[model samples]
Structure formats: structure tokens, C-alpha cells
Target: MRRLLLLPAIALITTLTLIAPTHAADQPNFLVFVGDDMTWTDAGCFGNSEVRTPHIDQLAREGMRLTACFTPAPMCSPTRQALYTGLFPVRNGAHPNHSRIHEGLRTMPHYLGDLGYRVALTGKRHFGPNESYPFEFLGKNKNPDFDAIGKFVRDAGSAPWCLMVCSNQPHTPWNRGDAEAYPPQSLTLPPYMVDTPATRKGLSQYYAEITYMDGELGRCLDILDESGQRDRTCVVFLSEQGSSFPHCKWTLYDTGIKAAGVVVWPGVVEPGTTSDALISYVDLLPTMIEAAGSTPSDEFDGRSFLKVLDGSQQQHRETIFAVQTTRGIIKGSEAYGIRCVRDGRYKYILNLNAENEFSNTVSQDGNIFASWKRKARNDPEAAELVESYVRRPEVEFYDLESDPFELNNLAADPTPAQKDRMAELRSRLNAWMAQQGDDGAATEMQALERMSPRSADGYRRWRAQQRRSGADSAD
Candidate 1:
């Protein structure tokens, strides 16, 4: 096994400097657009010809597109918390879906506030202990108040402001966009998905929702333009995660953790350029801090990727990590937790509770997956695909180049070189777990500690309802 170069992470960032305040005028304003459950490949800029995302395509033409951005955690709450806090989900104590952060953790608003920026978030905040994420919230709906966004940007005058606008489109119950625009028979499904009529309908609806989210993103960007802040503001668009489908939302596969990112920073970033630098959601906070003339704290699991923005550096991280805690999610796996490490090419997944069958809403309750099961009776390929979604080994490895969708596993009976690579990745993953105080299955067992009281109550209520109908699925 040849030793992989631990170039970026091995050396700790030590020269962190905190400059004096009054930096509002000198620093630039920032506006971030977040989309819910949007698959990266669906965006026209990323390589989809069917799903029309004209706004995202326009942004890509005027900015740099990120080809290898991923969230540290796949679920909504964990991903949002990690992005806001600049800490991995487990370390921040928000590893589970519908979870809350550990008390006393200072998030992006705190750090950016200290740097003289009025940080605010509008729409779809799935974090908790609300104080931890102290951004001047503009609205509480799934979509942003465009009037409020415009007023906020225009009111800031010369003072630097940071606003993150989130959209709830393209999530489950995908009903936001015009399904008519995407014909069921004309759409091309990903190779991983089953091609049944139900699957096509679901995918078409998903794509429609994506187009709707793109419109939402365009609205935010349009606000900046109307406010005359477009040139001065660094606009960032992020497609949160994959849509709700089999082998996507609740797993650590690329489709689950990978995200789409585009940035437009005038005079700094080159237009129409794309980079393959790996960026984790945790890196956003420190990047914001560094961009504002302050140094990133050593405590951040991610460092500033501002250099990637400025075009000074082409690479950011040698390896990126992700967490998937199926506990506490709606129709989730009881205790199936996953951890994985990926570099430029290969990936290693450690399924902590692999003995238990993996089950989620897509596999058990969704119409699309039911179609898959129905088709499986007559289609061997559909049967194989359906079976793979719910069952897995303790270890899974993939050569991403050969398997972009992660369809094949290379962990069992691997070649000597493949074994070495897997071992090396596993070693790094173990070190990361230790650093986050993530005791694998032990950490997963304490998920209730991380889940918020409200979320837990809701889960109990749902379980009770299931019992009343004589269809209780609680284990």
C-alpha cells in the first residue's frame, strides 16, 4: 500500500489573525441561495439537458461551478447545522435528523458578526437551540419573502450583509414546479433508478420541483441586481442534497452526500470556469471569516476555501468525510449509521449496524419504490437494484471512476492494491471519528440525546397514529 499524500489536512492552520472592527465598508456583502433535495446532475450546468434550470445555468456562465462539493451529513437538519456552525454534525451534537446542536456552540452569525457583517438567514432553517444560529432571520417559510430580501439588501446601504435564502422546493411531495414541462416518457432517469411508470412520474415531478427551486434562486439573485448589490455581493448557490429516492437520501453514496455549488464573486472568481476541488459544507463558515479579513479558527473541521474562490488554489481537501444517521428520521432505519471517507476517486463506507436491514420511506412506503418492487417480479435487473437498496455488507468500497453511481461494491475479495486503499481510507475515517468523539455504534445509540424534544414528540405521535391503524412499524 503506497501512502497517499496527506497534504492539506496534516498541517494545522496556525496564522489566524483577527483584525479590528469597522470593516463593513471594506468587506463585500454576501448572498447565498440554498435549494432542498436537488440532485446536482439535474442542473443544466452540471450536465442535464432535460431539467431546465436557466437561472442556475446563467449563474454558471457568469461564475465558477463546483463539481465536487458535498455536505458533511446527508439529512436536512445535520447538513444545515454543519453549514451554519462550521463543525461536523457529530462534533456539534446534531448528527441525527431533526436534531439540535450542543449548547454553547457559536455559529457563523457569531463569527461573522464579530467581523462586522449583519448576517441573516431567510427560509427553511432546520437547526435548533435557535440561539446557536443567531442570524437575523427574515422569514420562516420554505420560500423566502422576496420583498423582505429586497428591503434587507437595499437597507444595508454600504454596510456588508450576509443573507442565506433557502428553498423547500424539490423535496418529497414534489409538487412545486410544473410537471407538465417534464414529460414522463421523455425524461431520462439515472442508471441507478428503476424505469417503471411510477418511477418516471416521480422523477418528472422531482425535476419540475428542481426547476421551481431554480426560479427561487433566480428571485434571490434578481433581488441583488434590483438592489444594485449584484456587483458588490458575492452570490453563492448551493443545491443542498439528492432528492428523496432509493439509495439517495439516507445513504452515504455520492448521490446522497454530493451537492451542487456555484459562486459569483466579481473581480475575484473567473467566469465560466469549473473546479474539481472537494468542498465540505463545514468549510463555508471559515471561508466567510477568511474572506472578511479574519483568520479561520483552528477548531473548524474545514478550512477556508476562499483561495478556491480567488483562483489562487485549485485544491482544497485531500479527503472529505460524511455521516448518515438514520435514527430519528421520518420512516427511517432504526439504528443504521454510516460513515465514509472519499478522496479524489475512491470511497470507503463503514456501515456500523449493517446486521440490521436498511429500510426507509422510499423502500417501504413510496409509490416509486413500490413500482420498483412490482417490476422486480418480472425484471431481474429491477429485482437486483431493489434488493441492493435495503441490504448491505459491513464494508463497501467503490472506485468512483468506474462506478459513478456507486452501483458496484469492491470491498469483498478485492485486489491487493484495492485492499490497501480501503485500509488507508478506513484508517483516516477512524481518526476522524476519534476527533469528533464519534464512537461508531455507541454514538449512534445516543441519537435521542441529539434529537430535539419537538422532533421526538412528533415521532412518538406518528408512532401512536400507526398503532391506532394497526400498522405500527416501530421496533
Candidate 2:
């Protein structure tokens, strides 16, 4: 396993100087395609043979592929807030799902708009508080509108633009594509997943949705080509967080926080290159700021990785952190809180409230969970997986190189060196929590208090109504 060396502040300043700006007329436009609830290895380029993602694979072949990219949060709104603000979810005040950011914190629009760039967001506006992210809203639709996006790009005239196209695909109550195309019997399942009829069927639907998203990506790239901006544009495709399944979406495991990232900036990046630099979604805002020829703010928790993009740096950060809080979930769900720290090869997790059995939206009402339980009745391995999904220990550690699925907990049987490493990771996580003003139990209590008593009841009623109407209620 390769380890990352932490750069000194003075060295970072010097590296920033190496990123020169393009010509005034040739400033690169940024087009970011964010896939909701998609896991790290679902695309064709990421080694999934079952899912067909020709467009994303093509982008990898034409651009730079990041082998390891993680998000600050596994859920939707929290991750989006962190990505736009360059701050962790705890500091941004959107640590819980479906939550808003802090009142006065600025977003990418505020930072990039000051540099004479137009930032616009189309489709899925999961973020809130119009003032925090005052981007020009092009439109909102689950599906892509290539014609309108092309028009938006062309109308920008000579000014550079940053457009975020958020796609609501591969999310649950999956049903958006032709599920018949992906046969459940022929699909390959991950080690963390149980082999059952319902699990296979659910995974096939999810794969179909990923393929649909790929087609939409192809359409967006076509729009860029037709508009003649493909050469001067930086295209980024991000697989946001993980899918909504057991041991994936809501957990702080690698499967939950790790994301797939690909970037294609014509003149700045080499074609068909792969980078093993460690990066987080919070670093994206600062990178784009530097790419647009502007100085990044000192207040951001993330530093720019433009040097990595320019082929001048092999490493970015020595460690990355992730957080999760299940307070605002539906009624009867346990308030599970998790904090994690990971270096290149090892991961350490602290389950803040591990006394209570964990339960969330994903584990309760999905056919996938139903199938897992059904299989658990006859299979001991499936029973263990199901039990581990809900009953977690106070602390867990894993050497990711040896156990990528993180099934084996090494907290109890660490060697002397592993014990020291675990202590170091714990110290780092504690210091980060202090910096973010994260008082674990108190924070969870506050989030719980903020949730109205009627909110959970309302959510239950909404789910019932959706079931009656045959609508998707998997948010």
C-alpha cells in the first residue's frame, strides 16, 4: 500500500504558483455530472462487467481517472453541501440527511462568481437556503435536457461557466430503466451482499438505472461537442456516495464514503491517464477556483488539488474523514452516529452510540433487506451479515488492503504496530471533531430535538400514500 506524505503549508503555496491560467479567451468551462447514490465501482471503467456505461468509460479513456476519491458524507444533502462549500458536513451545518447548510456560509457560486464565472445548477436541487448557494437555477428535472443545457452554454457568450448536472438515477425504488435487459440470475454480487432472489433482482434494477444514467451522460457530452466547447471545457463525472443497500449507503465503511471520480481537462490533463492521489469532495471547490485563475479562500477546510491535475503532485492528503448521523430519519429509527478516519490502507471507525441497534430507511422498507432476512432463515453466512449490519461495536478497524469489504474487525486483535496506527487515527478523528465543534452525543440530541414530532409521522403517512399510489418513496 502506498502512503501519502503531508505537504507543508509553504510547499502548498509554492505548488499553487505552478498552476498558470489559460488565455483570456480560452478559460476552461466546467461541466460536473453528479450521479446520486451510485457506488464507487458500478461503472464499466471501474471494473463492473455487468453494468454497461460506455459514455463514462469513454470519458476515462479520454481523461484522468482518480483511483481513490471519498466524500465527506454518505448521504445526499450533506455531501452536496460539503462539495459546494469546501467544508465538512459538521462545520457546514448540514450533517444530517435532508438538512440545510449554515445560515451565512458561502458556496461555489459565491466563490467562483467573484472570479467572473457563471455557475448554474440544473436538475435535483437537494440543497436549500437560497442565500448559501445563489447559483442561477437553469431548471429542475430528474432526466437530462441536453438541448436546454447546450443553449445555456452557448448563451454564456465569452464568459466561462461552471454547470452542475445532478442526476437522480440508481437511487431506490429503482424502476427507471429496462430491468429485463439485466438478468438477476447472471449478475455478480459483492462480498458484502447476500445472494438471494430479491437481492439479485434489486441489484439488476439498480444496474439498469446506471446504464440509463450513462446514456444521459452521452447526450450531455454530445451537446458539448455540438456547441464546440468540448475542447476548452473540463468535464467531471462523480459517483456520489454509495447505493441504498445494507452495509453500504448509511455506514461509514469504504463502500459508503468512497466515490468514483473522472476528469477531462483538454490542455491541463494528459489523455488516458490514471491518478492514485487521495482526494475528497470538499477539495473540489478549491480546485475549481484555482482552475478558474482565482485565489481560494483561507477559510475553506479543503485545499486545491490542481497540482495533481497538472501532473506535478503525486499525493494530496494523508488522511480523509467522514461523518454520519441518523437522527432525522423516520420514527422508530435508532439515532446512530458514526465518525471515521482513513489513510491509504487502513480505516478506523467510532460508532458514537453503539449501544442501540441501528436501523434506518434503507434497512427497514426495501425488498433487498426483506430478501436478506428471508435468506438468513436458512443460511448462517447470510444470518451473520444481517446481524452485523444492525449490531455494531463501539470501535472497528480494518486493513483495507487485506479486507476491502471491512468484514473482519481488527480492533480486538491488533499487532503492536497496528495498535499504534489505530491510536494515531483516533487522535486525528478527535482533533477534527474538536475543530468542527462536533460534540458527538450532544450534536445528535440537538438534531433529534430539531425534528418535529409530526415529521416522522408525516413521513410514514407519505410512504403509505406512495405505496397506495404506486409512487417511488425511497428518498
Candidate 3:
């Protein structure tokens, strides 16, 4: 693996001074836009002709498009925590969904705060312990408040600022856009998705929500332009995780963990460029810290990718790892703990509790999942896809170059070379787990026990109702 290059003290001082010669005391401001449950290929820039995302596409046309960005977890909270703390899920104590970070763990706000930057979050409070984050709470609304955000930016007169604008679009119960505009019949479903009326309808709604999110992004950009911060601020747009669909959200597949990333800094990053850097969400904090002219802490699980942003380096990470623990989700979802490691070509997954069938909120209540189940009764291929999703062996491997969607599992019958590669990846994953103090099942069980009894029982009833409504049936 290539290590991040660090400059000497004198060279670092010179670089910082040169980057901000006009306003030596003022560091560059950061404006980050995060989307919820959005896939890497959902926007127009990523080749999704069905979804209309003119604003996000414009960012790609005028900024740096990162092709291989991924999150540390498929779920929202875990991924957000990893991005905030630059720590993996286990180490950060937020491996499970709807979980909090370990006490006394510092976040991006603390790191940027020390560098004379005012860090504030405008949407989605999915993280906790007020002291650990301490972000100036700008407000929590799923939709972007352009006027308020503009006011906030304009108010940050001199001191550097880092503003996080999070959007809750394209998530579950997707009902925020003009669904009629995206006709179900005209949709192009992925190979992993079944073709049915319900599936198409669900996809159309999800695409519509994506378009809505894009419009929101446009609004934010307009606000920045109005505030005269477009040229001075480093704008970063991130698609947090994949959409809430089968084989997408809550899974370690490419559709689940992969994220779309774009960075626009007028004087720093070259416009209309694309980078194939293998960056994970865990690297965002460190990169932003370095971009703010501050040295990143050595305790971070990730390193600064400023070199990649500045076009001085091409590769960022040789491998990225992801984790999933369903203990804090609906009750009886304890069986869905998984860990995965992926490089440029291959991906290896280890389903920790593979003896039990995998079941989560998506599989139980998602419209696409319900549609898949309905289609499986008559379509053999759909039935096979459904079976593959619910039941899995202990280990699975995929040659991502050939099977980008991870449809084919190569672990069952591997050639000699494949076996060697699998062993190497397995060893790497084991070492990472040990270093993170990941006890897998034991940890998940403990998390489950920590949940309130009432909440657990409520979730159990909710899941039971879903099962009774034929949501879990393949007939």
C-alpha cells in the first residue's frame, strides 16, 4: 500500500502560506453536501440516463469526480460516524445501526475547531454525545433551507467554516418527488433487480427522489453563489450510501457500499477532472483537515487524500473495508453481521452469522423486496435471485472487474490463483478485525442486549406485522 506523503515543518509552513497568500489568517472554507441512500451510479454524470440530476452533473463537469469512493458501512449512522471520526465502525463504537459512538471520541468539528474553523451541521443528527461532536447545530430538516444556509455562510465573516448539509432524500418510503415524471415502464432495472410492476414502480419513485435531491443540491450551489463564497469555498458533494433497495442498501455489495463523490475548489482542484482514487468515507475527515491547512492526527484509521485532490498523486488506498451489524435494527435481525474487504479488482465477504438466514428491515418491508418476492412465484430467475439474497454461505468472493454487481459468487469453486487471492484477503481482513477489537458475534449480542426492552419488543411486533402482510413471502 502507498503511504501518504508528509512535508517537513518548514515545507508545510511554506505550502500553507503559498496556498492562502491573500488571506494568510483565513483558511479555505468547506461546504459539504451529503445525500442519504444514494447509489454511485444514480446520477446523470455516472451514466444513469433515467434519473435527472442536472445539478450534480454540473458539479462533475466543473469539479473533480471520484469514481471509486466507498463508505465504511452500508447503513447511514455507521457510515456517518466513520466519516466524522476517521475511525472504522468497531473502533468508533458505532458498528450497529442507530448506535452511538464510543465516549470521548473526537469528531471532525473538534479537529477543525482546533484549526480556527467554525464547524456546523445543518441536517441529519444521526451521531451523538454532544461533547464528542459539538457542532453548531444549524437546524435539522430533511430538505435544504437555502436561505438559512446562505445566511450562515455569509455570517461566517472571517474565520474559516466547515458546513455539512445533509439531505434525507431517496431513502425509504420515498415520496418526495414527482413520481409521474419517472414512468415505471421506461425504467432500466439492474440485472440484480427483478422486472415486475411493483419493482418498476418502486424504482421510479426512488429515481424521482434522486432528482429531487439533485434539485436541492442545485439550491445549495445557488446559495453559495449568492453569498459570494463559490470561489473561496471548497464544495464537496457526497452520496452517502446506496439507495434502500434489494442488493443495494444494508449489504456490502458494490451497490450498497459504493458512494459518489465530487469536490470543487476553484483555485485548488482542477475543474472537469476525474480521479480513480480508492477513497473511503473514513478518509474524509483527514482530507478535510489537511485541506484546512491543519495536520491530520495519527490516530485516524485513514490518511489525508489531499495529494489526490491536488492532482499530485493518483492512488489513495489499495484496499477498503466495510462492516455491518444488524443488532440495533429491528428485533431478530441479529443474524445479519458481515465484514468485507475490497481492492481494485476483487472483493471478499465474510458473513459472520451465516448459519442463520439474513433478514433486515429492507428484506422485510421494502417495496422492491416485496415485489421481488411476488415475482419469484412465477419467474425462475427471480426465484433464484431471491434465494441468493436471503440464504448465503459463510464466505463469498467476487471478481469485481467481471461481476461488478457481485451477482456471481466465486468462492464456491475457485481456481488455484483465486484461492491464493482469497487467502490473502482473508488474512488481511482477520488482521484488521483483530486490530479493531472486533469480536463479531459477541459484540453484536452485547449491542442487542444494550437496547431497551420496550424498543426491542416494539421492533419485534413491527417485523412480525410485516411478515404477516406477506412482505417476507416469495410466493
Q: Against the true structure, whose lDDT is highest? A: 1
Give lDDT: candidate 2, residue 155: 94
Q: Each model's C-alpha lDDT?
A: 0.85, 0.82, 0.81
- Candidates 1 and 3 compared: the better one by lDDT is 1
Residue-by-residue lDDT tens digits, candidate 3, 1-475: 1112112211222232212223424468899999999988999998888899999999998889999999999988889988888888887777877667766677788777767788888878676556678888776565566677877888987768889998888777889899999999988988989898988888888898999888888888888888877888889999988987778878899999999999999877999999988999989888887777667766678889999989999999989899987665763464568999999999999998787667876676666778889889999999989988888889999999889999999999998999999999999998888777777777666664433455556766866775788654431
**Per-residue lDDT of candidate 2, residues 47-110 (tens digit):** 8988999999999999999988999988887899899988888777778776777566677887
- Prediction-by-prediction clash tally: 0, 0, 0
Instruction: For candidate 2, list the clashing residue pairs, or say none.
Output: none
- In model 2, the worst 10-residue window by lDDT is 1-10
Ordered from best to worst lDDT, the candidate numbers read: 1, 2, 3
What is the Cα-based lDDT of residue 91 in candidate 3?
75
lDDT score, candidate 1, position 100: 86
State TM-scores per candidate: 0.94, 0.90, 0.91
Clashes of 1: 0
> How does candidate 1 fare on TM-score?
0.94
